[model samples]
Target: MLLDTFGRQAVDLRVSLTDRCDLRCTYCMPEQGMTWLAKPTLLTDEEVVRLVRIAVTLLGVREVRFTGGEPLLRPGLVGILTACARLQPRPELSLTTNGIGLARTAAALRGAGLDRVNVSLDTLDPRTFQRLSRRDRHHDVLAGLTAARAAGLSPIKVNTVLMRGINDHEAPDLLAWCLERGYELRFIEQMPLDPQHGWDRSTMVTAAEILDRLSTRFTVTPEPAGRRGSAPAERWIVDGGPARVGVIASVTQPFCRACDRTRLTADGQVRNCLFATGETDLRTALREGGDDPRTDARIAELWRAAMWGKKAGGGIGDPDFHQPERPMSAIGG
Candidate 1:
């Protein structure tokens, strides 16, 4: 296992298949759209599979998640997932999607050995959904969720980004809906990952506050996990059916203390920190075909540097610190 400075072992890798997305969320992708990485910089399907192989064989990467500006946009996504599933001692493979194109692809992805899905859906109301997602596919997204369930994707996770005045009031309602549907509803604390979206901490809502609100309706209690890494979502069991709820406190509470995640950008750059200022380009090593020893040495050196740069806690203090990169979508959150 690749352990960091804080002794957090790297077990999961969130890989971005593409830097392109369909909808432009208010808090994520830029309003006027942002510049994307060049196609040549992006990792090919074979290169991505190679990286995953190395990560699992060498770095103890046991869980692989395909994310993106929207992973569904990648044409070869299903093929990549199939390859991961067929790996020796295959890791748990999953994908995070906006659910725009999920209806058509859910069954195909599940057939490809995708364990499950996490769909980004902040608002249940159609108008609010369109306002937040900048798309009029609320019904389609919901249909995607239904398709996921129909495809037998067990324990489907619906991610809700709680922005104050935007979807905060709908927390209880969303909780009720998830409980009824047997879906896991996860509330994510908005971070300033992309400052271009005009993120202000003042508008941020704390996990504690969300819990306090949720507790008014259900008996909230912690759910157990073998190991909780840097994902930041403190899970809980909720009322009605077997539905669960999780709150990812990245802003008010950072999980960097136990963060074991490494992000691979669509352009083949391995990012040590989600909010990291520096990224190691892995494409160069992949292209230099002749020297295996040199390639391995370079990748290892980059990994060591990234692990060395990991902090005891990220976003613990620096209230005024603005992340230079775009938010989760652009960075494959």
Candidate 2:
């Protein structure tokens, strides 16, 4: 296991397959999306697989999650996933997507050894979805979710970012909808990752406020502490039953102390934290490869050095916290 200076073990790696996405969510990017990385600058399928192999074999990473502007947008995504699954002592493979294209590719992805998925769906109302995403494909997202379930992707996670005066009022209703369909709903606190830099702490909804709203309708009880180890979402048993909901309080309540995640951008830069201002470039080392052993050693060294400097917490709540250069899509949400 790779242990940082703070004794935090890096067990999970989030890989961004592409910096391209279909939707332009208000919280993720500007109405007009920012410039995307050139295709030549993006890592090739072989390069991505090589890094994952080193991560699993040398760094002891046990979980690999593919994130993107939308991972489904990557043409060779299924092939990349299949390659990762063939690793010795294979890691748990998962993907985070907007779900617009999942309807067409869910079964193929599952067959390629993808273990499960987390789909981003902010609002159940079609009009509201369009207003937030700047796209009229809300129904496409719903269809994608249905297709994912039919493809045997168990425990589908629905990621909802709660923005006050917007979709915050639909908390209970959203949870009810997911519960009825056996989907695990996770309410994420809006972070300062938007490209427009319009995140306001004053207007952002808190996890406690979310629970209070759910309590008005359902018995929202916190699951026993320590049950969520290094996982961002805090689980809760709803209405004293098997149905559950989760809240990722990244802003109001930071989980950096227990954060065991590291991210690899589509261009092959290693990021120790979501809010990190710097990254370690592994793409250069891979492309300049002559000695495989030396390159592998350098990869391991870079990973350890990056994690060694992880901040104790994400300082978004600080008075002078500045947002990172890349938006959520490019950075791998």
Candidate 3:
């Protein structure tokens, strides 16, 4: 186990496939003048699989989630999923995507061993979706969600980010749409991961605000804490039924104490936290070090050392808190 100084073992690994995305979401990156990672800097499909294989088989990682600027944009995603699924322990595999290409690839992804999916869907209104994403493919996303459901992607999770004056009013409506379709909806507080560095805590929505908005329509009940188990989302029973809703209060209610996630950038750097200013270069080790037990242990040791140095929390509320140099796209989800 990659145990941190805080005694939190990293059992969940978030591996990024690429830093390239198809959509130009307003909160994620600028519509133009965005400089993407060079092709040579990206980890090959083989390298990604190798890292995940080691994390699962050697380091006791149980769940592996593929994230990216948009994971569905990776051309070789099916092959990567297939290789990771073949590991001896067979880690639970999932993906976080924007659902642009999922309409065509959902079945293939499921067949290639993807367990479930979490898609970013900020607004249900077509024009709002286009406005938020700067893409006119709102119907494509809905089709993708439907395809994922048909492909047996159990618990199809929808990730919604409510920006101030931009889709903030859709909380109740979003939850209602999700509940009707049986998609577990999770509303996330916008963080300071935008490339433009325009995130303002004063303007961002809060979990309390979301629940208060939701309470106007649905009876939200908090699920017992025991069932949460290091998951970021604080879940709720919607109207006291099987259908559920969640609020990931990352900024307002930080979960650093219970965080079990370790992130891997597409360039093969090990990120101990989302807001980390430092990164451990596992890519150099992977390429320079030979494939052997000694090399494997050395790689694990590097990861352990990275985790050991993790700060107590993301330090969002601190007066001197600094946003990471890399935006969320570069750091994965």
Candidate 4:
């Protein structure tokens, strides 16, 4: 197991397939002046599958979530998923995307062994979506979600970020829309991962405020506190029954103590924490060719060290807290 000094085991692995995105969401990155990773710097599809294999077959990882600026943009994605699905102790596979190309790729992805997906869809309004995402693909995202459902991706999750002045008022409406469509909705508190670094704590919406907004139209009740494990989202029963909603309050309610996630960037760095300022390089060791056992052992060793050195928390509450140099886009979701 990838055990840390704090007695936490990293069982969930978030793999970044690429740092390129189709939509330039204002909260994620600037629309212009973005410098993307060089193609050569990224891990090959085979390298990704191998690393994931090591994590699963060797390092005790059970869930593999492929994230990116948009993972759907990766050309070799289907092949990578196919390979990972064939691992000895096959891990539960999922993807986090902006839902741009899912209309074309959802069926292939589900057929290739993707179990589910968490797509980012902030607003139900097209104009609000364009203003927030800096793109006119609002309908495209909705269409993609429909495609994902038809493709049999179970419990297709919709991740929404409610900005203060932007689309905060649409919480109730978003929940109603999601409930009607049977799409699980999760509202996330905006973190300090944007490249522009314009995050303001006062102006940002909190989990309490989100629930308050939703309560206007839905009788939302918290699930038992003990029910939430390492999952980032704190789920709430909606409308008194099986229907539910989640709030990922990364800033206001940090779940770092129960964080089971280990992030692998598109370029092959091990990130113990999302707000970490440092990274352990696994790419160089991966490229140093050797037998599969030897390479896998080395990868496992480095991963263990990275987790062992993980900080107690994401550090957003500290007086000296500073945002990570790489934006969320480069670092993956």
Q: Each model's TM-score, in the order given? A: 0.92, 0.98, 0.98, 0.98
Model 4: per-residue Cα lDDT over 145-207, one tens digit each: 999999999889999999888999999999989989999999999899998988788978999
lDDT of 1 at 270: 81
Model 2, 1-78: lDDT tens per residue? 667778999899999998878888888878774899998889999899999999999998999999998999999999
Clashing pairs in 2: none
TM-score of 3: 0.98
Residues 63-140 of candidate 1: C-alpha lDDT, one tens digit per residue: 999998899999999899889899977999988999989999999999999999999989889999989878899998
Lowest-lDDT window of 10 residues in candidate 2?
A: 284-293
Indicate whether candidate 1 or candidate 4 has the larger lDDT: 4
**lDDT of each residue in 1-333, candidate 3, tens digit only:** 888998999999999888888889998989988888888888999889888988998889999999998998899999999999999999999999899899999999999999999999999899999999998988889999999999999879999999878898899999989888989999999999998988888998999999998999999999986998798999999888887898999999998999999999999999999999999999888888857657777888898899999999999989999999899998998
Candidate of highest lDDT: 4
The TM-score of predicted model 1 comes to 0.92
Better of 1 and 3 by lDDT: 3
Q: Each prediction's Cα lDDT score? A: 0.82, 0.90, 0.92, 0.93
